[model samples]
Target: MHKEGDEIHIDEQEASGGSKEGVVRWVLAGGLILAVLLMSIVWIIPAMTQGDIEEEATVSGEISSMEGGDSTDSIVGIDGEPGDGGEVTQEDGIEVIEN
Candidate 1:
């Protein structure tokens, strides 16, 4: 009869130890989930939702000089009023086109 009581007490102790380990496992899992959520909000989400860079040129009446480049330097210019005979000249690192 005494041995039966001892066995019951041992089983209870083992059950409580298992419960503590289960609680620790849950706490670690929750911490990892929270860290990932914060990282997404502070870094990943903003990086994914950023706007792309765009360049546009629009000419209405007359344009003096317009410059744009992606991997090289390029310039477009019209040096006088419309219908005025314009001279196109080439300079170092500049390109000119006559229309």
Candidate 2:
């Protein structure tokens, strides 16, 4: 079997250069899509947290507002015999002093 000179010699550039333009376009499009998605997430998280979203338009994994998050004062302290590891007795109430 005899092959022509051009057929026998395949340039290295031919192996990868043919699709360079297409690949670049795809990468740019992907970057644009990613930027848009990031912006939307940033905008949406605060909007949802601030109760800007209606009850029907709520998305999954949305952040809740912090209006009542400071109500952690209702958390009961560990009631036990006073000792190491912050153990407490019933007479000695545990008061969390948060300044």
Candidate 3:
């Protein structure tokens, strides 16, 4: 019952609605891609490209004397005698002083 012009007009309206829907879908897809790119740049790229901290070196050494002597016989203190007020004792009895 509709005229030819009326049917053509209705088809045009439907086509315009379809085009609008397509534009909305494309815009949403573009927005999702942009969000993913920004997240990668902000959070992932920096962590991947970061550098490590530098370490320091440590040193150690020991002391030695050239004089060949009985280093173990070195006196440290005096032992206390029964009457003469405690006798002077040396560390390990290695008497450095002949008292």
Candidate 4:
């Protein structure tokens, strides 16, 4: 009867010990997830935002002029006359049509 009591006491101790380790593991996992989220917001989000701005700047720079020369005069529309719908005309020796 004493041996049976001792075994039950040991089992109770083991159960408590296992529960403590489980709680510690859960806390550590929660802490790691929090750290990752914080790092992403602080570092990754800003970098992504900055990347979009940089891409826009690059696109604007590319559109400023074509490869060989200044292309401002070579381009038309918006600055030129608004076209009559579906009308064909000749301008700058190029056929202009609005469809």
Candidate 5:
């Protein structure tokens, strides 16, 4: 019952609606992608790059000062001295060693 021109007009309106929907979907998808990218840069980038701060040596300073030295030997139980046995004795309210 419809003429050719009327059929063509209906098809045109449907195509226009489809095009609008496609554009809206594309915009939403693009916004989502942009938000994800920004969140990654803001929240994730710093966490990924974070590391423990280390001591930086000056060019003229001696490297030996940075290295842990013979001070560890001063610890009593660590040296495995006789009668140490992971025990500290209390004498005069202070720890004294029989070794």
Candidate 6:
């Protein structure tokens, strides 16, 4: 019912029309997603880096061992010699170990 230019303008306006509420909802949704992503990064960064702190807490200047082992070692040339003492004998209610 109008000129070609008028019809085209009317169609363009109709196609481009968007509700204000819809735009607000999209912006809010995007903001919520961004906030969640930022929160995850904040939480994850510290969680990944906490291992170093735990390791530092467990460490000291002198090296400590976790495995069970003897506290003393007999040197090859020192304690390997045979003993000159006679063999010891244990009796009832008594215990003995020969050198």
Local error of candidate 6 at residue 13 (angstroms): 13
* Per-model TM against the reference: 0.34, 0.33, 0.33, 0.34, 0.33, 0.34
* Model 1, span 1-99: residue lDDT tens: 125644733566565665544788899999999999998789866655554321123242113223332423333336633565555668886755465
Put down candidate 5 lDDT per residue, 1-99, tens digits, no spaces: 235854633566565665544788899999999999999899777766654342224332335444647554365675446677765578889766544
Instruction: Report the C-alpha lDDT of model 3 over 7-37, residue by residue, as the tens digit.
Output: 6335565656655447888999999999999
Which candidate number has the best lDDT? 4
lDDT of 2 by residue, 1-99 (tens): 235965665565665656444788899999999999999999989776764456425544233433436545443434333442344334457554321
Q: Write the per-residue lDDT of candidate 6 for residues 59-78, one digit (tens) a residue.
A: 44123432325435423333
In terms of lDDT, the poorest run of 10 residues in model 6 is 59-68
TM-score of 3: 0.33
lDDT, model 6: 0.58
TM-score for candidate 2: 0.33
List the global CA lDDT of all models: 0.55, 0.58, 0.54, 0.63, 0.61, 0.58
Kindly report which residue pairs in candidate 2 clash with one another: 80-88
